[model samples]
Target: MPTATIAEDDDGIRLDRWFQRHTKDISFNIVSRWSKSGVVRLDGAKAGPGDRIAAGQTLTWPEELPVPVATRPTEKPREPLSEAQIEYMRAMVLHMDAHAIVINKPPGLATQGGTKQPTSVDAMLDALQFDAPSRPRLVHRLDKDTSGVLLLARNAKAAAFFSKEFAGREARKSYWALTVGVPKIAAGTIDAPIGKQPGTGGEKMQVDTEAGLKAKTRYRVIERAAGRAAWVEFLPLTGRTHQIRVHAAAIGHSLVGDGKYGGKESYLTGGISRKLHLHSRRLVIATPGGGTLDVKAELPPHMAESWQMLGFDLQLGDIEIVEPPPPPLKKRRLSSATSGNRRGERRSRGATDEPKRPPRKK
Candidate 1:
């Protein structure tokens, strides 16, 4: 018998699917027959086609049968990255450890590739492999024009753990932006629902309270440049596309240079940079083994210049502003007779506040 050890990248995959990836010539029918005959074994134990395999496990197959090989065309080889490309990718690294890599992704670079997008952070992931058994995985994303701390998982186990943290809202993020005008409320929450607009093929988002997903953002006015613009810090409670932008606009203080949702009013005068002034400032999330990964990324050049021109102090003290959750709906105390069943059930019929008319005159 011939045996092979599973790789980390192939962990938690079905036995049949693993064979299909490694040996394209092996059909499902053949694998099923081999499994039933006990020719396919995992660690000397009989394994089935549907059995999930893990890393470091041993898989053995009969040697008497012909070797399974791929008859399909080979995949195109990845191009070698240039020295400049490697430097560019590594320059953005803010922190790196056994399980995670935090990078300050620059503005104008898409997190992932799309139509007509030739380059992206995902495409350059190969450059950041750096002795890992597998390529790092993107746990979350930032917009193309937004710059900030982007975390990447170095392996599958870490990837799964980080993804769960994000999905469960265990991760906390803070953003800094230059708003067109001072918000009426200095510190408060913007509880607005947002959804994809009807037209534009989902390219934009709008506040659709009637049919939108719940989105909340807590903001504090960090500093004010007279009444023209204000430096704001945002903490989002729910992850939604363009949530901060739409919510900021909903409050009548759109982020500076955000024309998509803010319109022309977003552009600031007095030599302020006409670029979207949103930057992911801080991220706090739990790591796989233990402890937490908290990192802060520096502002990009354009935004830094804008801040300097506005006379906003980067070292100014600020506090974490969290909005208190809405109060619970008051419960209607049901009478003992109706307590056992749902409300309105087991209730006396025709019980009205008005005095019951005497059974006069049938």
Candidate 2:
């Protein structure tokens, strides 16, 4: 019998996974039979495959199959990357340190992959590791066509640190966008909630202030182009799917190229290209060592072209950045009569991942 001991990091992980981790040569059927036959024992007692384990537990294997040859590899093979892709990633590095890497990600490149998207920045992330011991891990994500600053933690420890900052909204993110029309107020907060569109197969998102997830953004109009378009800066207080876009539309000034929410009529035809005119302009966040990281990305080519065409200043001036709004309070379900009357009830903002809606079908 070959006995193994579980460690602290493996606590709460499944038992079958333990076998997959330590006994890679053991087949699925063997694990199932051993688990059923009381041959694979835990703490001198029988254990099931789905049992959640804790640290300091001992596992005993039967002598019959007895770990077999144990020749097969445990870790899955990484997808191969071409040299071109590797160089492309290196050129995008905006900031690099021992713990993290920041990239000025370009428009049309997805931060992660999907069923339809085979190749993405995430798929190619292995190439981005310069000399780090491990592949850089994405700490945050930007929408595929919404280009700008994105952060990657160089190691597991750094990943946990950055992940906490975002989860707590201690990180500040600001965006620049060109909207179809000027908002009635030059500077104010748009506190509309967001959710997936009802009939759009969850492909599109809209401002559903009534029953939607809590979402908020603050905006200040930098300049307006004679009732045609307005250059605006936004600080999203909560990460929600299509949050800034939905909030802009809620205020009747959707982003110029956001046809999904605002319709094709929102985009200007002649010279300005109908691309999503939003950019993740800057990020101000804390580093692992009690220091701060302030990073800014320049406007992408299409946005720069639109800026020149609209006579919008390339210099955005000293824009005010504010702290994210306090998290929304949880709402208790109210009676129908009270629900309509209690308009002041608070809503909750729940976003497990950076809230970019899944890509729409082509």
> How badly does each model clash, as a count of residue pairs?
0, 0
lDDT (C-alpha) at residue 41 in model 1: 89
- Go through the candidates in order and give each one's C-alpha lDDT: 0.80, 0.77
Q: At residue 15, what lDDT does model 2 achieve?
A: 81
Candidate 1 structure, TM-score to reference: 0.78
Q: State TM-scores per candidate.
A: 0.78, 0.72
lDDT of 2 by residue, 150-203 (tens): 999876557778998998989999899999977656665666677788888987
Alpha-carbon deviation at 9 in model 1, angstroms: 3.1
Q: Which stretches of candidate 1 lie over 4 Å from their true place?
A: 1-3, 11-53, 60-76, 322-362
Candidate with top lDDT is: 1
